[model samples]
Target: MFKIISALTLFISVSVHAQTPDSLLKPSPIKTLTTQQYNALIKGEDQYGMGLVAELNGLPSPDRALKYKKELDLSPTQVATFTKLAVELKRKKIEMGNFIVTNETKLETMFRTKKLNESDLIFYTNRYGLYQGELRNAILQASLKTWQLLSPQQVNKLLTFKKS
Candidate 1:
């Protein structure tokens, strides 16, 4: 009886002290982003789902327009134009994203070192807004180009595709 009680006590204590394996712990999505993901965002990977703006304007992005080129009966010229626009837009987004990321790092360091002033803060924050606006504008411009390229019938067909 004594030995059984001791074994039971040891088992209970061991179980209580057991550690959960690290593999069993779930990572937080917001906090556990990998470096590649951070780099992609800094390099303008559209982390904020900004492509939705094109859809809101009743047009597809250059990439999307290209994707549905067959269904839209796009001419070879239209295809060439969209390809150029997509490349240009990608470059613009990266440029703006690089500016914004550099500014953000500077602002963060300044704040950490207690070098921030009201005007400086406003300037930095406004710059962020401008960078975002420019990114959004580039996306919209591509959408506008796609809209111009497609006919009304093609637009209707694209809309139907969007629905399904």
Candidate 2:
């Protein structure tokens, strides 16, 4: 009886102290974008931005127009008109991106090499604001186009799943 009780106690203690496998203990999966997916999404966004700008600015490029039109199931004429606007917008966006990149370096150089001044800071801030405005317009235009393409159900799904 004593030996049996000792064995039972040891068994219970060992079982109670056993560690769960790390894999089984893992938390629930979180939805997140992979690096590749993020890059693709960014590319898709630029394409969308270009499409909107071309449509709004009256300089349709077929490539830019098709990007949005294919997604939206728009007619050929609508695609053409919108593409023109998108292309123009894309051109502006490219210029803006480049300008910002260049100006960032200019600011760094001013601080590191030349010494920062009030006028330099003001100029840099103004350029940044301008770049921000251009980007904001592009994002709004793309979102508007996307909303137009998505159905009510699709929009609901998008809204529900969208992280930010």
Candidate 3:
């Protein structure tokens, strides 16, 4: 009876941990923000989307920075660099957001005109493609910069922490 109880408890513990958002294989922040807040932020501009794009591309958040600063054994010097990197990323995000707004006006013009047909639809879709491509490239740049800022050993530690 003791053996059976212990085995079951171990299995349950492992299962619960596996389901956690910080699981090693998951690269994204799993925290959920309320839909109302998300909608409010995204309504006027695509800057919010740019931020998400950066995150999806592995640009670490401030929260992630705090987690890694301790885990990676970063010095004061590195922390300062990381803060600068984050600021650069924010600027890139804003640029992408502005690009989206510029494209949006063109898209809206096509949308409002009765001239919209198959070709117009194709053109409209292309605008979104361009915006997404630009956004993704900006994110990639930030991710690469962040990677350069950290040592391999620190990255390995991050992986281990995620697994734990």
Candidate 4:
């Protein structure tokens, strides 16, 4: 009985020690983003699901529109339109993404340096929200424009493919 109790106590102690929550208290390297997020942001890719909302709602992304161009029997003019829209969207997204990353870096620095204050925090957070909204709008508007360029049959085909 004594040996059994000792073994049980040892097992419980080891389990508790191994389950320490130290990782939860540790600060992230960038504060605002994980490594993957930082990489995606720098590459002009959407790190958030902002664009997926439009994509799922019957609006294809610029890349998808181009990919299915042959299947959709897109005319030269329609292709040119999509190309221009995509270029504009990419430029705007990159600009907005850089702004967001710069502000996030500033916020991270303030927190790391222990200089964060309530008013500054609120201001920075709101600024970040505005930038995010702008970025999402740009992507969504591109999606809408792409949808407009597609014929009704092409739209149905795209939707069917998406469902599959």
Candidate 5:
């Protein structure tokens, strides 16, 4: 009887533990933005995770352009051009980021309040996508402008600089 009771207690404990909900499986109250996503949005950083696609494809990001300006032997005009592009990119990215985050909050509210409908859903999704594209375009266009500012030799050097 003692052994049976001990085994039953152990089984019950194990069953209870197994039935406990995992924190990972539990839904967040916000339901949309993870903590990191929220931080990036609030800080006006790239939340789309595609900010470096241009750099990965042999184009220089604005910071990178500025970083290697002297090494790339950039002309004063090129430096000025990259600076202007960087300023514009930062401005546009912040604007678009705010737009994206606002739309995302609306999306979260719709789903959270059980007010989501097909039309509203489609509208927010499309709006979010449009803003995402604009943000990416802003970054990529800056990269392209930076690339154009560099000479062919400078571009080649920038492209291969990482390997060495």
Candidate 6:
């Protein structure tokens, strides 16, 4: 009976630990993002609130452009264009995020399993740079497209809205 209770306790402890997020176990100022937040990150949403690209270019992101649709007084053509840009950005973000995550996982697994090789490491690391560059390009391209579509006045008006 004691042995049975001990085994059951061990099983419950393992199950509980397995269900816990690794982030919660770590010591950090930013611990335990919710599931939705993590999923959004995976989906390529800028959960970290980094706006270096958009700020540097003086361009709003697609979703931001759409948010002030009325204030911007976007034409039908503009609406369609911005909508398309948003959709494309979303698709690209998801695609890039998946590639990064998969490669990161593979790289870690290789190290953990003692299968890592120098050439493969260099290739994967460089591949990560490419992924980051591509993702940045996609984001910048969308902003550029948005900027091109908007009139000077419209752009200035968008600049007035604080980021939500």
Of the pair 2 and 3, which is ahead by lDDT?
Answer: 3
Deviation from native of the Cα of residue 138 in model 1, angstroms: 0.9
- lDDT tens digits, residues 25-144, model 1? 553222334444446555668777676867876888878878889988999998999999999988998898678767777787787789989999999999989998889888887898
RMSD of each: 7.5, 13.1, 11.7, 6.2, 6.9, 7.9
List the candidate 3 regions with Cα displacement exceeding 4 Å: 1-63, 115-127
lDDT of 2 by residue, 1-164 (tens): 99999999999998767844422344322123333323333343353343454345333333433554444456666565556656765676667655655666577678767798898899998997787577657655654664464456544443333122
TM-score of 2: 0.46
Candidates by lDDT, descending order: 4, 6, 1, 5, 3, 2
Worst 10 residues of 2 by lDDT: 28-37
Worst 10 residues of 1 by lDDT: 22-31
Model 4: residues with Cα > 4 Å off, grouped in runs: 1-29, 162-164
Q: For residues 1-164, write the lDDT of model 5, one tens digit per residue.
A: 99999999999999878863433444433457665565565566876656577777788876677778888888888888888888888788778867877898899888878998899999999999999888888888888888777778988888876632
TM-scores of the models, in the given order?
0.73, 0.46, 0.52, 0.76, 0.74, 0.74
Displacement of residue 56 (Cα, Å) in model 6 is 4.2
Between candidates 1 and 4, which one is better according to lDDT?
4
**Model 6, span 1-164: residue lDDT tens:** 99999999999999888875743543321223455454655778855444466756678777788999999999999999999999998898888877866777678778878998999999999998898788888887888888888999999999988876
Please report the candidate that would top TM-score against the real structure: 4
| Cα shift from native, residue 96, model 4 (Å) | 1.8
> Higher lDDT: candidate 2 or 5?
5
The pairs that clash in candidate 3 are none
Model 3 per-residue lDDT at 71: 68
Q: Is candidate 4 or candidate 5 better by TM-score?
A: 4
Q: What's the lDDT for residue 137 in model 3?
A: 68
Regions of candidate 6 where Cα sits further than 4 Å from its true position = 1-38, 47-51
Find the number of clashing residue pairs for candidate 5: 0
State the lDDT of candidate 3 residue by residue for 46-111, as single tens digits. 334544654554455433565668767887887887777667655655665555555555566666
